[model samples]
Every structure is written in C-alpha cells, then in structure tokens.
Target chain A: MNAIEVKDVSVYYGNLCAIRDVNLNVKEKEFLGIIGPNGAGKSTLLKVILGLIKPVSGEVRIFGKDLKETNKILGYIPQTSGFDRNFPINVLDVVLMGRLKNRLSLFHRYAKEDMEIVTDLLDKLGLSDVRDRQIGQLSGGQLQRVLIARALAIEPKIILLDEPTASIDANSRSQIYSLLKELNEEMTIVVVTHDLAAVSAYFDSIACLNKELHYHGDKELDEETVEKIYGCPVELIAHGVPHRVFKVHEEGYDD
Target chain B: MIEAFLQYVFLQRAVYSAVLASIVCGIIGTIIIEKKLVMMSGGIAHTSFGGIGMGFFLKIEPIIGALIFSVLTAIGITTVRRRTNTNSDTLIGIFWAMGMALGILFIAFTPGYPPDISSYLFGDILTVTELDLKIMIALTGLVIFVIVALFNYWKAYLFDEEFSSVIGIKTIFLEYFLFVLIALAIVALIRVVGIILVIALLTIPPAIAKLFTFDLKKMILYAIFLGIVFSFLGLWISYQFNIASGASIILLAGLTYIAAVIIKRS
Candidate 1:
C-alpha cells in the first residue's frame, strides 16, 4: 500500500494560490525528493501532507486512512533556521517531547525504557556525548541531528523534512543527506528542497513541482525534464557531487 | 518586623499570603517566560482591575471579582489574538485601558462609604486578611496541581505549538488552559504586589533563573527560591524604612534582574 496519497489538492493564502490540483502517490520506503524553486509551494505541499495546512480542495490519505486520523504515523522536521537555538533546553529534553504517547500522566515518571530509547537514539546518531548539552551550544550539524533524533523518537512510519539543510555548511549538508539515506531503509522519507544535485544523487524518486505537480513520480531527471521543471536552462549545481551534470552547448540550449 | 508578626494577626497573615503569592509566581512565571507570553500576562494582570472594581461596586470580595474578570479577559484576548488579524500589541493595549477605565467607573458609581481598594491598586501587603491568605494558598495549590499533572503537555506546548498540535495534544484547549492558569496566578498576586507591579514578580524571578539554567524544571525551582528571598528582603527593607512593602518587593526583584543582566554581560 502507498504510504501517502494526495488527490486533486489545491491551497491558497488569502487571494494567492500556492499549489493547484496536486496529486501524488508515495509508496512505502520510497525516498521522495520534491524539488522546486522558491515560492513554488514545495514547503506548502509538505505542510499539507503533515496536516499542518489544509488544502483548499481534494483529499490526503496516509496508509489508507485520512491524513488527520493517520497523522501520528508521520514525523516531521521543520527548517532548523526557523527556531531560536538559544532556547534553554537540553537535547534529551527536546527528544523527550516526541514521546507524547508515553506520557501517561502528569505525575508519571519517564520510564527507564523511555530513557533507554533516548540514549540509544543519541548513541546511534553519534550524539551521546552531548545529550546533556544546551541546544544553543551545538553546531548546525549537531543541531540538525538532534532534531532528526527527536523526529525519529516517535517511531513514525514516514518522516517528512522541509528544507532540513537550508542553512548548514557543506559538510553538514552531505552528512544530513547521508543520514536521510540511511533512515530511508526503515521508513518512507519525503524531503522538500531546492538542491537539485543532492536530489539527483540520493532521492529514490523525484517530484518536480512548480505551483502544480509537473512531475509526480520519476528518478530520471534528463536535461529536458530539468529545464522544463525549473523553467530555465539550469546551471550545473553538482559542486563535485556525483550527479549527471548538464552539458551547455549554445546559450539557453540543451544538448 | 519579625517581632511584629508575633503580636499582629494582620502582619502574620500578610507574611503567609506573600509566601503563597510567591509560590504561584515562581511556578507559573517559569512557564510564562518560556512560552514568550510575558506581554500577554501583563495584559491579563492589568485587566483584573475591572474585576476589582466590580467587587467594590457589588460589595463583594475584591480578589474574587478580580479572578472572574481576569479569567474572562484571558479567554477574550485569546479569542481576539487568534480569530482576528489584529496586531497583538493593539489588542492588549485596548484591553489594558478598557479594564482600568471600567474599574474607575465602577468605583465612582459605588454607593457612599465605598470599598477602600487603594491597597489593591498600589498593593499594601500588610493589609492581607485571613480570608485573603486562605484564598491565596488554595489558588497556589490548584495551580501547582494543574501544572505538575500536565507537565509533559506544558513542555510540548511551550517548545512548539504547531508541533504540539500535530502530535494529538489538543493544543488549542491547552492554550486556553494555560491562559486561565496565568489569570489565576495574577489574581493570587494582586494583593502581594499590585496589578501594576505583579508582572515583575511573574517575570523577573524566571528571567534571573534563566541566567543560571536552561532547564524549565530547574528554572521553576530556582525562581521559587528567589521569589521568597526577594519578598522577605523587600519586607525587611519596607519595615526598616517604613515604606510600601509591595513596591519595595517589586523594586528588589527589578534591581536583581538588572544585576543578573550586568553580571552575565561582563
């Protein structure tokens, strides 16, 4: 069964339309990369899938249930740049927030098992040494990993990330993508980003979106398809990443 | 002053009530600062004045009236903040002025030998009665029970409201529940530190605690201890100089906040 299905969806902000008549089907364990330019409704589409924003039309089903009913099956990692990193919280405390189901009562203690799970995630993510450290004290890469640990703590069947590597350095970006690749083995993963090179190399399937679902399912990003999706003859953004670089012939020409 | 407590029932009541007020301030204050709702809290604190006026007009206990008015205004502000696209500052400002105006109007309309609410306005901690002490303690106990019982929810809600809502936390209701707690805490503090000065006690201790620790639970415990120390120090200072205890206490808290800021900066 498909992990997520979006049918005939559209969204608006006041008078401005964002996504229109968007339809998609994401099979389980698929690493789906959604690529679009800024203001192309990439993030908005992710929000729609996560039930954070309701599409003005159409239906969203996750694992054969309504999105709202199946929301618990999805974990989300929003952009790291969107928060105040100086907030007074330790890594363990932040991750524990994802364990909402285990919170039996106000007076109920976090069980030994819960702590064990947190420690295990911390260790697996190579963050065990800094579990007690303040969030503000961490590097961009470390902070991204902490947010991933929090998202994974819920054991969701699918994880959605919106611009996870937007502000990080090059090393952190590759590490984050590699981590996403590894996590794709355990759960379906959907990422919304503008990094075409990483999308070509790591994502199992690519969805080229620009206000509408231009290409809902494919991994073969030929030069023509890339040019069509971006509405321009794209520049080579490979930056030494293992991607099929675009060969420029004449001006605005694709070989 | 310590000797005075031994002989005067009112002084003893005032001291006990001050402690109770501090407990509520410390506990709820931590959540307030963490949630970044200090300004919203100020609005509610000032809005309680309308209730105080109502109490005087109806010949009822002022604290009881303050509690009702403050909780309603909290709910009202939450509505306006959510449903309307109006700026938050504008909404708060309107309620703040409306509350004070209604309070003054009610006081003016009260029959001859009107209720003496000068202490409630400027805060005279020494005027606390046994009834006020009982009310403050009971309110503090309730606030502790709610906050502790829903500690997990508070953590989740405070950290990220959108994420909390997505995680099946009934975030909207929790938001209202928290606002009501803020309202209750404000009313409990009205006698110890007048409405004008209550926000200081609600915010200063937690702000100081944040300087030392990043953990919410630790911040609360630290703030509670600071609240007690500052209250007593202010009480002692007022006794020595024959000044206003409420103003003295708020003044001490404010000064300590400045000190903490300077120390951290250096």
Candidate 2:
C-alpha cells in the first residue's frame, strides 16, 4: 500500500495558485526528493501533505486514511529558517512536544521508556551532550538535528522534511544526509530542497516540481530533463557526480 | 510602620489584592512576553476603560462591563489579526484611542461623576475593598486551574501555532482561549494597577525573569516571585510617599527589568 497519495491536489493563497494539479504517491520506505525553484510551491506541497495547510481542491490520503484524520501518524521537520533562534526553550522540552498526544495527564512524568527512546535517538544523532542546552544556544546544524530528533520522537511512519540542509556547514550537511539515509531505510521520507548537488546522491527518486509536476520517476534523468525542469541547458562538469549545471542563457543571469 | 500595616481594613485588602494580582500577572505575563503580545495587552487595558465607563454611565458594576468589553475586543482583535492581512497594530492603536475617547466622553456625560475616577486612572491601592480582594483571589485560582488543565495544549500553543495545529490541537480554539484569559486577567487587574499601568505589570516581570532562565516553566515561576516582591515593595513605597500606587508599581517593575538587563550584560 502507498504510504502517501496526493490525487490532483491544488492549493492557492488568495489569487495566487501556489501549486496546481499535483499528483504523487510514495511507497513505504522510499526516499523521495522534491526539487524546484524558489516560487515552485515545494514547501506548500509539503505543508499540504503534512496537513499544515488546506488544499483548495482534491484529496490527500495517507495509509488509506484522509490527511486530516491521520495527523498523529505523520511527522514533520520544518525548514530551520522559519524558527526564531531567540525562542527560550530547552531541547528536551521541544522534543517532549512530540509526546504531547500520548500524555494522559498534565502531571504525567516522562516514563523510562520515553527517556530511553529520547536518549537513544540523541545518542545516535551525536547530540546527547547538548540535551540540557537551550535550543537558542545551538549551532544551525545542531538545531536542525534537534528538530529531526523531535520529529523522530513520535516514531512516525513517514517523515516530511523541507530544506533540511539549507543553512548548515558542508560537514554537517553530509552528516544530516547520512542520518536521513539511515532514517529512509526505516520509514518513508520526503524531502523538499533547492540544493540539488547536496541531495542528489541521497534521493532514490526525484520529483521535479514547478506550478505542476514536471516529472516524477525512478530512473536517473539525463541532462535534457534537468534543463527542461530548470529552464536552462545543462553544462558539463568534471568532478561532481553526473550532475546538471544550468548555463546562463538570459541577459541578467548571474554567474 | 507596623501600626500602619494593620491600621485599616482597606490597607490589608490592598495587600491581599496586590499579591494575588502580581502572581497572576507574572505567570500570564511570561506567556504574553514570550508570544510578543505586549502591545496586545496594552490594547486590552485601554479598551477595558470603555467598559468601565459604560458601567459608571449605566449604574452597573464596572468589573462586569470591563470583562464583557475587554473579551469582545480581544476576540475582535484576534479574528482581525488572523483573517485579514491588515496591520493588527494599527487596528489596536485605533481601538486604544477610540476606547479612551469614549471613556472620557461617557464619564463626562454621566449624572454624578465620582471623584474616584482618579482612583481608576491612577490606582488607589489604599482604597481596595473586600469585594476587590475576593475578585482578585477568584481570578488567580481560575488562572492557575486553566494553566494546569491545559498544560499540554499550552505547550504546543506556545511553541508554534501552525505546528500545534498540524498536531491536531485546534489553533483557533487555543487563540480564543488565550484571548479570553488575557481579557479576564486585564479586567481583574484594572482596579489594582489601573489601565494606564497594566501593561507594565503584564510585561516587565516576565521580561526580567527571562534573563535568568532558559526553561519556560522556571522562568514563569521566577517571574511570579519577582512580581510579588516588587508589588509589595512598590505598595509600601507608595504608601510612605503618598504617590500613585499604579505608577509606583510600574516604576518598580521597570527598575527590576533594568537591573536584570544590566546583570545579563555584565
């Protein structure tokens, strides 16, 4: 059974059509990458899938249940840019938010099982040392990892990420990708990204999105498909994996 | 000094009401400051003036009027801020000025404008009655109960509204619940600190408390403690100097905030 099914979904913000006629399906344990430009509605699609925003038309079903009805099953790691670093909250408290649904009482202490899971997850992410630190004091990479740990706290069946590596250093970026690769083996993962070079090696399948679904398939694409989706021609590069580089065809193009 | 403390029932009532109001302000104020709604609190306080004016004009209880008007204004502000892309601050400012204007005009039109209007303007803490003390205690209990009962939901609500809604916690309901709570707190505090100085009580203690702690829960507790201390000290100073209790309390809170900022910088 498909883990997520988006059937001809359309979303709008006032008069602007953020995304339209979008259709996609994800199988269990598949790693899917969504690639698009700045205004390409990639984040909007992720938000709709996660039930953060309502679609203007069409339906989204997760594991044969409607999107609204299955909120508890879906875990989301939002883009790090949206959060205020100055927010005064501890890492443990933020992670504890994931367990809010299962809490029976206000005074319900964190059980041994809950602590065990949190400790194991933090240890795996190499963030056990900073468990007591305020979320505001962490580096961007550390904060991103903490957000991932929060999402993982739910032990969700599917994890949806939006630009998980946009602001981190190169070494941390690779570490995050490796962590995501490990997570993808356990659950279905959908990531929306603009960093094509960084994420290309990790994604099993690519969904090139604009206002609509330009392409969605498993086989690695040639230069032509990448150029078509990006609105430019692919140039040859020597060192990187057979990647696509768009040439400056327009007058105002930079670099 | 000891004789002065117990000389009058009014003075004793003032002490009780001040302590209760300070605790409520400290806890709820931390949430307000964290949420960056200081101006919203100010707006609520000013709009409550209109309610107080209506009560005086109609010979009804001003607290009831303040509760109704402040809650309605809170709901209006919340809805307008969410639904329309209009500048919420502009709407708040407009209502703030309008409410004050309506209040002054209504009081002037009333048959017998009591000289106690000055007491509501700049709070007469020395004149606090037993009824005022009862209201303050009841409101404090209600605030504590609501915070405890909705502790889990409030954690989500305080973190991120969209994220909380994604987790099925009903963002709209939480927003209304918060506004209602704020309105009730503002109304209860109207008599102790008055409308002009209520925002200071609602924001300063919490802002000062944030400098010392990273934990939200601990920050709230510390803020409450500091609020009570400042309120008592401010009341004593006001009594000794024959100054306005409302202004004195706000000045004390401001001084505490400044001290916290300096210590943090050092």
Q: Which has the greatest lDDT?
A: 1
For residues B5-80, what per-residue lDDT tens digits would candidate 2 score against the true structure? Answer: 7897778888888888888887789888878788988998898888888888888877777788889999999888
Write candidate 1's Cα lDDT for A1-255 as tens digits.
Answer: 999999999999878999999999999999998987789999899888888888899988999899656646888898887666767789998888777762236675677887888889999999999999999999988998998898888888999998888878989899989999999999999999877677767888989898888886667666666667678755443334344633332343333
Every model's TM-score:
0.94, 0.93
What is the per-residue lDDT of model 2 for residues A1-255, given as tens digits with 9 covering 90 to 100?
999999999999889999999999988888988987789899999999987778999889999898756757778898877766667787877776776663335544667787888888889888888988998899989999998988898889999889998889989989999999998879999999876665457788889888898888763665557667667634422124333322222323233
lDDT of 2 at B71: 91
Best by DockQ: 1
Model 2 CAPRI quality: acceptable
Cα error, residue A110 of model 1, in Å, equals: 1.9
Give the Cα error of residue B151 in candidate 2, in Å.
2.3
lDDT of 2 at B246: 88
Assess each prediction's global lDDT (C-alpha) against the native. 0.85, 0.81
Segments of candidate 2 deviating more than 4 angstroms: A102-109, A232-255
